[model samples]
Target: MSKVVINSYEEFERLLGQQIGVSDWLEVTQERINQFADATLDHQWIHVDVERAKTESPFKSTIVHGYLTLSLLPYFWNQIIEVNNLKMMVNYGMDKMRFGQAVLSGQRIRMTAELHSLVNLRGTAKAEIKFFIEIEGQKKKALEGIATFLYYFC
Candidate 1:
């Protein structure tokens, strides 16, 4: 899908309550899970120890950490939209964030986002986007929540 470009607050305001865009599928490999584990110092067997997880874990495989999945929000959001003419953008915060399903290693996940609300605070733009991370071939979502971002258009 082509990216939705927002050059100004007015353009962003137009997309309120609409599905903005979808990101390409990203695979959660054991290597990625291990890298995240190393980066965060979280070496739980359910996330890193593949050999043990296969036998001990009910999932029969290593699962991606909840934080690891949540951390990819910005990455996926970038794929969904490109806000040009910005001096800078700040991650305002996230609200109503929920983790619904576990992402097993090797499963592909993609995100769908909607522009839930848009408000202009003087010159700054506050965009509240509702996003859902879905695992390929799974009916349940891996994660879902509202992410707020502040855009400073130049």
Candidate 2:
């Protein structure tokens, strides 16, 4: 998939309130979930134990951790947009984050983002993007939130 390139802060400002783009679908595999669990030291049975999850978990399968899914924001965002002429970029923060559904392992998910707000703070650009992480073929979104980014345009 092609990325939407924003050459300048002005161009990004013009796209305010519009959906920038949707990222390509990414599969949430068991391996990824296991790695994430190991990295974060969150060895929950519901996430790593396949057999136990199948027998006891409500989801019927090992599900991806909510934080693991949230952590994909940067990777997914890069797939959707590329900001040019930037000296650096920082993950400012997130707000109103909601996990609406569990992402089962092996499910495909993609992110759709809209420009919620943008402002110029000196030479830096503060961008707030409202994002929805959707599970393939599901009616409910896996997660939704506003992700803030600080761009230092050179």
Candidate 3:
């Protein structure tokens, strides 16, 4: 898919309340989940133990870390849009975060993003993007939230 390029605040502002773009599907492999578990020091059985999880967990498989999926926002967002003329960009914050479903290991996920709001903070642009992380073949979203970002355009 082609990225939605935003060279200025004006360009971004025009797309408010509309879906910016959807990202390509990314697989949630057990190896990735284990890596995330190692990085975060959260080696929960539900997330890292495959055989144990299959026997005990209702999902019957290892699940992806919620934070891991959340942290993937930047990767997915980059696929959806390209922001140019930028001196820098900052991850501001997240709001209204909700985990609607547990994404199992081996499940493919993709992100759908919309420009929820945008404001010019002096010379910087503050943007709020509404995002949904969808699990392949699932009706329920893996996650949903509004992500805020600060765009510094030169």
Candidate 4:
């Protein structure tokens, strides 16, 4: 893997509108979703009951919870190119978010982020990255959001 280096805030701003690479696909397993449901106390039939899903749910299969899908971001994001020599980076938070479609269990998903905005926060760089959570081969987006991250150089 190449070491991605950002020498200064200007460098990150220069990356605006550029498409970061597609992350490796993450499989949405029923077991994982079930575990998430159990942990969150969300035992909705659409998420936990496979038999009922097949018969009643429009997806015809158990689906991963939207929050679970969102929570998987850190794993999917690690596949992104990193800034070499950066001291630390923080998940500052998201500015806006929307769940566009359902993620069915047994499916795979990946992310494509575009640098949308960059601002200098004194010594740190604050960036707004728009992410499209893409389900392989699907035209509809599973999730869309503008995530903010702060990168500080020591």
Please report, in order, the local distance difference test score of every candidate based on alpha carbons.
0.94, 0.96, 0.96, 0.83
lDDT per residue for candidate 1 within 33-89, as digits (tens), equals 999999999998899999999999999999999999999988999899999999999
lDDT (10s digit) by residue, model 4, range 6-70: 66777767777897666888898999998999899999999999999999999999888999988
Off by over 4 Å in 4: 1-8
Against the true structure, candidate 4 reaches a TM-score of 0.89
Least well predicted 10-residue stretch by lDDT in candidate 3: 1-10
The digit string of per-residue lDDT tens for model 3 on 58-119 reads 99999999999999999999999999999999999999999999999999999999999999
Winner of 1 and 2 under lDDT: 2
lDDT of model number 1: 0.94
* Each candidate: RMSD: 0.6, 0.7, 0.6, 2.0
- What's the lDDT for residue 59 in model 1? 98
Model 3 spans with C-alpha error above 4 angstroms: none
Write model 2 residue lDDT over 72-132, tens digit each, in one string.
Answer: 9999999999999999999999999999999999999999999999999998999999999
Q: After superposition, how far is residue 63 of candidate 4 from its true place, in Å?
A: 1.0
Ranking the candidates on lDDT from highest down gives: 2, 3, 1, 4
TM-score of each: 0.98, 0.98, 0.98, 0.89
